[model samples]
Target: KMSFGTGHHATTFQMLRHQGQLDHQGKRVLDVGSGTGILAIMAHLLGASKVEAFDIDDWCVENGNENFDLNGLTTRMGLGTIRDVQPQGEFDIVLANINKNILLDEMALYADLVKKDGFLLLSGFYTQDIEDLTDHAKPLGLTLIAQQSKDNWAALILQKKA
Candidate 1:
């Protein structure tokens, strides 16, 4: 199994557990703020044809790569900001486990990167922050599908309108 090798919060793992069985067969996936790249690796396990991950911290890029190898999953890693990273093409699914402010700021970009009817999964926010998050994302044509909360953290699943 892959380990974070740092005292990171358990929310990331929780997000993975709550991500129900998905049909990612031959799908394209993008993981933002990939950290240890657990989510990206999980995407591959779920049968994503291609998984690309990005992180601003170089250490994360290295650690993520290590974890990917540990999991025996192949993925592409890059150093880039969420605002600067352009999606090569529309993805079937996009996952962002980031803070509320950053999520709000980049919601439009994330929305644009997903194909119509594609899904966007977001975590790293509190349940109390959902209203603002939903408000920010709605204008971009995203609809909330489900929400999973643990303690103070919450994850939201959204789908881009077709």
Candidate 2:
């Protein structure tokens, strides 16, 4: 069974809210660990020109595609990590709502995919984990610009330094 996002979790909600705050019009976006494709769909509705999403789980990839189809949106949903999926070029905005360990482990790759001065939004970690995340991000030229927390869950929006 695939564990998909229902937009009910604090992290997902915060991610959604953060995404809403940003202007996605005509932007190229990437949704890492896309789960049920909620974020990808939201990006489309927000006017992103291109959206690429992937997950390590085959079920998630399939389910996410189904969700996209149901929403009548065309999305590039694949099965694998960012390295395995190998999406080409940098994105105007990158969304990663995965856990702390995976976020840290793939931070460099994520940073590389963000266009200079573009945004990377992250969640799925505890509020206490923010410092460690930002710490790792800073050296990669990603600076924290916005943050939101619900209960113990947290989300951050970082910009790739131009």
Candidate 3:
């Protein structure tokens, strides 16, 4: 596959497992750096009213759209960073399974896109890097609500403070 996130990597697996536990019914979700659209598809399957995704890689964007098609979902998939995505108002949940550097750089943008009291799920970093991620998120008013780890990889669920 040209894209990433086939639910095989530890980070992707934890992201999927943690995402399944959330209540997605009737919610608007955003998936950042969506590779193969796995997380975006999961949101739809979980009952999210709308699912949108974006990736920096062109191949990933194409693969994501194909995956959405296969899943019978009409998700809006874009090719670029979060900044390039068209505004669709605040989301009920924002999932970013990107690396630590990108997450840290875009933390504020992600926070701004989530509705107050909504969720922000993140992964794609080592368990030891959780502190750096959390520390950066805290000031953005995103409180760490839950976390999962496997094989030194970690995923975090945070809530935007109202």
Candidate 4:
């Protein structure tokens, strides 16, 4: 299988670091726009019991599946837009690494998929975009917990308040 970690932006690595510290043991995770499924694979490695990922592109879905298998991850991969997915239940953690526009548009939906006090990690935005994204997320019951940046890219970790 082709490697999925080739030549991506440095921000991805930063996000991975934050994800590493979280306790994924027996947790359920959802990875949206899971390009190469890297984040999902990482979640599995962190001891998540189950990981489900989706992408709008068939190629990404296929590659993500392959990567998951290569890493011995039990993650499920599917092809569909995030809006098309109807999650069976709230997730312990949610990872989204898509563009800013899509992130903002889907904020409410993402909030609903998170369990109370669950973690929501979002990337694919620049530093300048944080305020707008946070402002949009506020009404959805998400509060900013942390932020990380590399180069021009940024990642925000939000939590659903109890």
Residue-level lDDT tens digits of model 3 in 1-162: 556799999999999998898999999999999989999999999999999898988888888898899998986589888888754699999999999999999999999999999999999999999999999999999999899899999999999995
Runs of candidate 1 exceeding 4 Å displacement: 1-10
Clashing pairs in 1: none
Task: Give per-residue lDDT, candidate 3, residue 3.
Answer: 65
Candidate 2, residues 41-125, lDDT tens digits: the string is 9999999999999999878888888889988787759988888988899999999999999999999999999999999999999
Q: What is the lDDT of residue 48 in candidate 1?
A: 89
Task: Rank by lDDT, highest first.
Answer: 2, 3, 4, 1
CA lDDT, every model vs. true structure? 0.81, 0.93, 0.92, 0.85
Candidate 3 at 47: error in angstroms? 0.4
RMSD values, in order shown: 2.4, 1.3, 1.0, 1.7
lDDT of 3 at 36: 92
Candidate 2 local Cα displacement, residue 5, angstroms:
0.7
Model 1, span 12-53: residue lDDT tens: 755685455456889999998887887888888888899989
Model 2, residue 103: what's the lDDT? 99
Ten residues in sequence with the least summed lDDT for candidate 3? 79-88
Quote the lDDT for 63 in model 4: 90
| TM-scores for all predictions | 0.90, 0.96, 0.96, 0.93
